[model samples]
Target: MDRQLAERLEIFERTGQVAPEICRFVRTELDVLDAAGSEITEESAGTLTSHLLLALQRSRDGGALTEFAADETVRAELAGHPDALEQAAALAERAESALDVVLPGQEVRFLALHLALLRQREAMR
Candidate 1:
């Protein structure tokens, strides 16, 4: 995930505008996921599922890194539906597992946000 963020940060850094907002959001999300990963078992699978769905939607809204043209291979892979979502969800699940073990009693508000975002994306689609 850090690798993915590094790649995205590099792209946004080149854009020279909206860098702060994008950087902050991406970094925060990464931090939350990292925290979740560190203590996942306490989290519910449904929560992780929700987060994956929302993340997919947010990815769509934030341009999803799917339109760069230069990274057709990555785009195609992500566009393959379940494959990308599954991989991302798996990561979230791992994070949830970690969160459960270390940060027990935590709420998955982000997951819910992700789900809502995904639903909006689907409606638009």
Candidate 2:
């Protein structure tokens, strides 16, 4: 894990904003991404990390988003990047297994959008 991300996770754990299991799950996900050849940096993964944390917290609290209206334009954009969508779905599945929580399809789509955007940014650089 990146030092900055580890520190951030520590802060969240210390502040009681994130459960230890959630932190561990995030760390494991980062490791998985790293092993898959994706650059796991604070800048590249900060938003994704935050989103995963919040999603896990919400799941634990039983406060899932009732409806997630993904923008059609964004969905269309993501549709062009099937690899990202597949990766996101795989990650979501792992999260479900690791955290023992079900992530709604909308949440999965949002995760895919983040990944697609990240891939686009990386390609530009």
Candidate 3:
């Protein structure tokens, strides 16, 4: 296991309330971010991890956030960054498979935004 993942798992285990599956899901996303060299800030990681875990829990509970529709403004903005859009779509596909839930385009756009923001942060650094 990656050191980061091991450390994260340790923390999750200490929480005593996290399900093993949730930890696996979080670890998967963290691994993906690490593999892509995306270094999100600790705050971002905490927020993203919480959201991802909640999403997975909802999926498992048969109550996915299915009503979040992407507006044209979001689509238009994402169109400006074709690469980010494409990468996000691909990542969303993997996330769907991993979570066994079909995320709405808005959720996928959120993922793109996350990646774009992370990349922008890296560029700023």
Candidate 4:
């Protein structure tokens, strides 16, 4: 397994948890982003997977962090591409169902921020 993935698996095992299958869902999202022409890198995948797993754990632990007010920087970064936001929302929704917790807008926006950062990285490539 990839180093980051192995570390993630360790986190699950150490916590008395299984792989949760949500990783597959995240992989699908990454695939979708790639299909849409985003040049997602290995580093980005590792970062995103780690983040998503943590977010899922947070949801299960009843922590949504905070509420999100609209941010133009995020909007400006993702302008003309609502799909990025949608993708994040989809992941959050999936996490909610799998973890059985309510996720706030902040979590969704955090996911979108990750997507936006990936896109920015792609542009730099």
Using all chains and alpha carbons, the TM-scores for the candidates as numbered come to: 0.28, 0.87, 0.67, 0.62
lDDT tens per residue, model 3, 1-125:
34553665657656854567667766776777767777644544555555555555566666766665555667787766677767767866776776666656666676666666666776776
The better-scoring model by TM-score among 1 and 3 is 3
Off by over 4 Å in 3: 1-19
Would you give me the overall lDDT of model 2? 0.79
For candidate 2, lDDT tens digit of each residue in 65-116? 5476655665787779899889888987887888887777667777788788
Worst 10 residues of 2 by lDDT: 65-74
Q: Could you give candidate 1's per-residue lDDT for residues 4-118 as a string of tens digits?
A: 4455544544665334444444445555544645222213233443333334334434533223333444434345354334534554455445332111111222333333334
Candidate 3 TM-score, true structure as reference: 0.67
Could you tell which candidate, 2 or 3, scores higher by TM-score?
A: 2
Report residue 115 deviation for candidate 3 (angstroms): 1.5
Model 4 lDDT per residue over 1-125, tens place: 34665566567646754345555555556666778887655576667766766666566666645654665555666665676688788877766675565667666677777877777788788
Question: Which model, 1 or 2, shows the larger lDDT?
Answer: 2
Which is the leading candidate under TM-score?
A: 2
Which residue pairs show backbone clashes in model 3? none
Clashing pairs in 4: none
